[model samples]
Target: MSARPEQREDRRKDPVDAIVDQWAAVRPDLDTRAMEVFGRIFRLSRSMGDRMEKAYAPFGISRGEFDVLATLRRSGEPYTLSPRQLSATLMLTTGGMTGRLDKLERAGLLRRSPDPHDRRGLQVTLTEKGLDLIDRAVGAGLAVQSAGLSALDDEQVGRLADLLRELLAGTPGADH
Candidate 1:
């Protein structure tokens, strides 16, 4: 015997619902439909970010460092890109990128050498160690994410992705 629809609905109410109810009691004219949606999104992002950080921990890389290595690994054969290109692609400041590059290079995970095409530029390339690490780290991260989405069936996941994509596309400053 399953619970009634109204009973299920009551069980689904979360912290955001409580907040909305509080607002409603004080301000009946206020509309909180968007609040319910974004509040859950924010909470989900925070929780998943923590989980991802833990997933990458055993690889000796923080989530940000994992992103740096993953970026190079995804760049195809030779796994090289100019520092400027990396900064632009990662949407990170040049100084911030330099720090990550320095750390990775020191770890023997990547190397920096003068760009043959441009004397003033340097190229960053993933070493065999970096390549191996990213491959494993990516799998670990994906497993965490997959587990997180296990509650949703494939169809629901696809629908959620499409809706989120549409919402992100419409958001200002979210270009690309």
Candidate 2:
């Protein structure tokens, strides 16, 4: 059953505030209030990630694979990226990127070819089969993300997005 507005607000407050209360109880001088926001953000991230993983499951790819495919698909026509470019964009180790590329190539979703710009390096591109799979996977992934934030009204969601964008932009290690 759906909660009444007051009840829903109370439910949200109780658990999260209880955490801060516990910290204040044991260590009164310490300020742990930021935990409320950071904790919620962490929970939201995990929940959305879990949902998106389920969304990608039918396409037979993990979240990391989906990330690579989506990055290539978004890179515009030719849908190609060098292994270095992909690894940098994804912040993956060379071995990690190589592993994902190997799995996708084996799955017949993508292929690696000699980089035209740098003959010594290889580039990755989505096959026609990869294109179709990623198109569907992206659509499904968006649906999952949309549903995850459906609790918020449009204005709240927009405001939250803006706030998050600002925070992410200022944070260390976020894409500059």
Best prediction by TM-score = 1
lDDT, model 2: 0.87
Which residue runs of candidate 2 sit more than 4 Å off their true CA positions?
1-11
Candidate 1 local distance difference test against the native? 0.89
lDDT of each: 0.89, 0.87
Per-model TM-score on C-alpha atoms: 0.92, 0.90
Model 2 over residues 121-171: C-alpha lDDT tens digits?
A: 898999999999999999999998888888899999999999999988888
For residues 1-176, write the lDDT of model 1, one tens digit per residue.
21111225546778888887777778767767788789999999999999999999999998889989999999998999998888888899999999999899999999999999999889999999999999999999999999999999999999999999999999998765
Residue 35's lDDT within candidate 1 is: 81
Report the poorest 10 consecutive residues by lDDT, candidate 2.
1-10
The residue pairs that clash in candidate 1, if any, are none
lDDT score for residue 151 of model 1: 90
Residue 159 in model 2: lDDT: 99
